[model samples]
Target chain A: MISSLTQAERGAAMLITLSGMVAGLAMAAAGRGDPMGAHGWIVLAFFALFFGLLVRAAYETEAPEDRSLAYYDDPTKVGILIALAWAVIAMGMGLWVAAQLAWPDLRFDAAWSGFGRLRPVHTSGVIFGFGGNALIATSFHIMQRTSRARMPGQVAPWFVLFGFNLFCLIAASGYLMGVTQSKEYAEPEWYADIWLVVVWVVYFVLYIRTLARRREPHIYVANWYYLAFILVVAVLHIVNNLAVPASWTGAKSYSAFSGVQDAMTQWWYGHNAVAFFLTSGFLGMLYYFLPKRAGRPIYSYRLSILSFWGITFFYIWAGSHHLHYTALPHWVQTLGMTFSVMLLVPSWASAGNALMTLNGAWRKVRDDATLRFMMVAAVFYGLSTFEGSFMAIRPVNGLSHYTDWTIGHVHAGAMGWVALITFGAIYALVPGLWRRETIYSWKAVEWHFWLALAGTVIYVFAMWNSGIIQGLMWRTYGESGTLLYSFTDSLVAMHPYYVARAFGGLLFVTGAIIGAWNVVMTIRHVPRQIPAQDRPTTPKTMEPALPAAE
Target chain B: MEISHELFVGFSKSFGLFYLIALSVGITLYAFWPSLAGRFDKAAKSILDDEDGPCR
Candidate 1:
């Protein structure tokens, strides 16, 4: 009976199972006196019925007439749309909360609206919600296209999608309620972390399974990077999040390490999160999309492979750069700084290859806003990597460590590199997946391009100005051998730059909104009817050709 | 020294350094080897084999 159903129906049933179990857990956790218990039981019962109906629906639906027609699964299309929704939510909150720096008067009476809580919501939401979903969705899409195999199957893919989002949901709600584990980028509590582990392991298996089924003799370059991303993230997440729960039922947990050891573990995880999550996965995207859009292969396959291993091996050592001025040993800090400097070579190898792929296609780069987004993203990748290497130097880090300069550097990377490449890849993928002939509006793409460019410029400038000013003011010594400026004096001086930073953020949010609208319209678009001149000409004769002229 | 952060940091000075250098050199040699060029080329082209031209 189950064999009679389609993959889509099976996917729907899997969602039912996932939701039902989660609802059951919520009800169990609620206990008797909890105010949410009534609501929990209701949701649980709803899921139970929903599960039954989904199963019934699956049994009734007919399987596809041709097995070959459904070779690739498409949960990615749904994942992409949801990723856009998250990007909007994440950036919207980011702008609102950031504006509060200039107008701290925007403060709300509610605890959830506090800048402290909203900051995590913005970080995690963008990194995980926006960026994570894009990585998963694009990885699934690129994995299938490269491997020439169906997705690992219907139910498992849905499990990954639904389960990962469940983790995101728990994380967001938990933060609002003040239930974090207090580790930046690793803040989700023990249960959420464990659930992410399960979801990620399944994702790894699914990727390996797809590769094993490939029609080609060799796995592609993109798959190698994607695999590194998945495996290393799992390692990083588990090692960084080792903690003992205060109790079985409560959301509180304590890290396994304390003092300087804890700080070391956190930065190791933090900087590498930038390494793996921000860099590696998007390098996978860059490998696929840039070449495909430019209608050329990467300039040097050898460089990519060398760089791939180079980045993976070196990024692990560079995390201690985040701990330079801290209690971490001088030798350890030197090791990190040295490897970080070494990293620039490999990082640029990939970034340079992306640009070189477009070498003969400069005309295409000029004309296409999509390609321009990608090209600029590569340039920023090169620029930011160079910046990171120098910034890791002890003297440079000493001056820049805790200033808004660090914020400037981060936005250069986050706004400039990570977000741009993701945007470029999305623009390329949407039309292909949505079965549209072109974007619903190229005008919107152009608008998005300028808006994002302007926003990033304004943001970087404002932060750089404010950060350098803050650093110099704080360090300035009076001729009397006394500190020149009070700490509050720096804050007073920073208000204008804060307002400018907020303005930049608003502009970025606007660009993202425009991008979201363009994508939505494109997805809803019907394929245009090609006019006679526009359509490819068909051969007039229907005569069968003789086989070989025999 | 015990098997601890202190011990590990001490060990990392030489052992960790050599391990990474070795890994980098090994990967570089493997990537640039003459015999594997054809395989790399095939992998590069694999993403294009099933293309139906971007639904456009």
Candidate 2:
């Protein structure tokens, strides 16, 4: 990675690394005898390790090659590897958490290993660690390809990738250290949030700089979604994390908003994090990789534009649906519900656009495990979005809210749509990125696909069953007009389902491990040969004469 | 004029509703504009022929 950089960029990297080390040292000194101090030591070690590498590489002579002749794929390559690593680690944490629930005594005798702490570790690890890394890596690949322009700077992409991972590291570690802001998704405290803002701004700037130099006059639809993902996520992160640290050196902080206002802001940030972070960014992947792999153009370009705008507009208002029947204003809740229901139009439109793009490619979908992953992802995207809209209605929310139903719904989207699409994209990208003819083993790909599908189906079904039963049991009335079942009774009833859920999670994690192994084997064994016509080209000024379809 | 809750709700109930409706219509129209269809189609197919390396 260091060998690819010009001497100037290497010098800049050293300077940045040095500054990061100093900051970490300062934090370590200031927050002594605290968890923040431990985090500071971690940060120092992290940058220090990088600094050591940078120093060792500093002696090497730089190669004189035109940097713009190839896409900056080193960061993307590293980012994908890091993402797969996090998928194994974090999804393994997910399985552990699930097991802990089924067998409550399954944890170690330590505060860090407790359910409350490890739960967020599992969450932030998967969401921000695995999912976030995938988005960043894929975005880098997609943005460059779609624009047909090289990334404006070499150092900035590295900065964004590593810097973002630093933030993820701090987040996952903080959760284990019992440090949090106690918010659902925005749990990372003030310092980590601030660090992410710095990283995110650089990411945004990198995107815009590349786009500004695009050879294509028309920005593709994928770039639009990616831009939205970056831009809106920054807004959400900053607004939701508006907090005052109890001490400048400590991890503890107080939120700017109070009570219902805090609830509203949190969910707004929370749900939109889902919208922009999970859905939109992955949708960007879906747009680019799905069609590219199928060797087909999008079915309706106009529908793509329509759905893009529709989702952008509708999803913002839909966050309040999470606040339904809460202390939040009834009207606001209704507004959220209304927009969430309206959101289905664009959601389905995009899903339909994807499926319709596969019209003549049905054979590919049938035969190719990678394509089937994407196909099933689109179906799940449609399914979960419909379920989301249905659940947002107040009466439905009354049953689904605080139940495992919400968990089922989220995983249906996360595992089914987001994770599946990511795996599909990764499989589609791997051989190409590595300059291999094809994957090392097609059988492994097929195995991973079926394993992932079975795991997701089993997990979702178990959650749905447990959720509805729990929701019903809670509301059930005896003849004496009392609750029919105690909470313990419900817990007892849920034991079997919990075991099933954990078993399903174990299967999912096993599939991810297999996928990771396959990736490694492919990289190791596959012979290197660049595909023909796989190089970027200069823009053609002359407009092509074509026959209009409509 | 002072911005009060009453004023905000009343304005939103009337003007906000109309404005959103208008905006939605405008976006829909912009997406479906007959002349722009070809441009959109071009955008869709533009990246299909992308190569792995940057322009030399």
Candidate 3:
């Protein structure tokens, strides 16, 4: 990795690392008495280690090949490996969290081991750590190929990838140390949030720079989604994480908004994080990889346009639905419900477009596990969006709010749609990035597909049953019209479902382990091969294609 | 000359709805415009040519 960089780039990287080391040391000194000090030490150690490695490789010569002739992919490779590692760790945390709910005695007598602290670790780790890395990696790969241009800078890509991982590390470690801002998805404290802002700005600049240099006259459909994901997520993260830290040296901070405003702001950030982060970005992956793997074009360019703009417009208003039946005004809630239901139109349009693209490629879907992952993901995307719109209705929210039913709904999207699509993209990506003909074991992928599908089914069904039962029991009344079931009654009822959920999580994580091992073995054992038509230096005479609407 | 909180809310309540509706319509018109079909088709088929590597 170090040898690939020119000497000048290496010098610049060293300077950046040195500055980061200084910042870490200052934080450690300033926050000496608090948990913030420990975090400061972690940041210091991380940068120091990188700086040492860079210094060790300072005498190494630059690679002879012209980097601009080829797409820069070293960072994407590292990002994928990092993402898979996070997948195993975070999903394992999720499984542990599930088991604790089933058998409350599953934890040690430690604050970090308790449900409250560990739950956010699982949530943020999977969503931001695993999911965020996958988006960044695949976005890099997809953006370059679709545009036919190299990333504009060498160090900037590495900075973005590693800086983002630094932020994720701080976030996961902070939760274990009880250093949260207490917001749901936006949990890391003020300093960590600030770091992410820096990383994200660089990421956005890098993306636009590459897009600006595209050989194609028209930008691909996938680039639009990736750009939206990068651009909108920055706005959401900045606006939602606005806070006043009590002391710069301490971890505690107060939100800028309070009461109902705070609730609205949090969900707006939260739900759109779902919309843009989880939904749009993965849709970018689906748009590119699914069709590429299937040897087909996207079915409808017009529908793609409609879904892109519709989702961008409609999903923003739908955030208020998360605050239903609360201190929020009814009109706002109604508006949220209205848009959420309307959102189903474009959501299904995209999903249907994907399935329709597979019309002639059904044989591939039958045989190829990687393509099957994407197929099942689209089905889940359609199912969950319908479920989401239904649950957002005021009357339906009444039964679902604060119940395990909400949890069930989340896993349907998270496990079924988000995770399945990510795994599929990874399987598609790994062989290509490494220049291998195919994966090490097709049987493992087949096993993984069945395991993952069965796991998601078992998980979603268990949640549905438990959630409905819990919701009904809580609302139940006896002859005197008083509530019949005690709160413990719901807890007892949840025990069996919790066990099932944990078992499902185990299967999913097991598949992930298998997938990760397959990747490692493929990288180590597979013979290197290059494509005949794929060399970056090849000259092309094809005309650049433009979009119709543009 | 200050825009008070309630005033802003009321303005948004009335104006935001119509503005969003207009935007949605505009997007729809742009997407379905007949002239774009040729370009869109070409663009869709554009990615099919790239396999196993970056486009040249």
Going through the candidates in order, what is the number of backbone clashes in each?
0, 2, 2
Write down the C-alpha DockQ for each prediction. Answer: 0.41, 0.61, 0.60
Query: lDDT tens string, model 1, A130-180?
Result: 889999999988886775555544666766876687678777766776768
Lowest-sum lDDT 10-residue window in model 3 chain A: A541-550
lDDT of 2 by residue, A117-167 (tens): 999988888899999999999999988888786676578998999999999
For model 2, the stretches where C-alpha displacement exceeds 4 angstroms are A538-550, B1-3, B52-56
Model 1 TM-score, all chains together: 0.90
Maximum-DockQ candidate: 2
* Model 1 spans > 4 angstroms off: A1-59, A528-550, B4-6, B53-56
Kindly list the per-residue Cα lDDT of model 3 for residues A1-550, writing each as its tens digit: 8987777778889999999999999999999988788889999999999899999998877665565457788889999999999999999999999999998888877889999989998999999889999999999898778777677657898999999999999999999988888899999999999999999999999898777767677888898998899999999999999999999898888999999999999999999999999999999999998898899999898899999999999999899999888999888899899999999998999999999999999999999999999999999999999999999999999998898889988988998999999999999989878989889999999988888888889999999999999989999999999999999999999999999999999999999999999999999998887765542323232321211111
Docking model 3 quality class: medium
- The lowest-lDDT stretch of 10 consecutive residues in candidate 1 chain A is A532-541
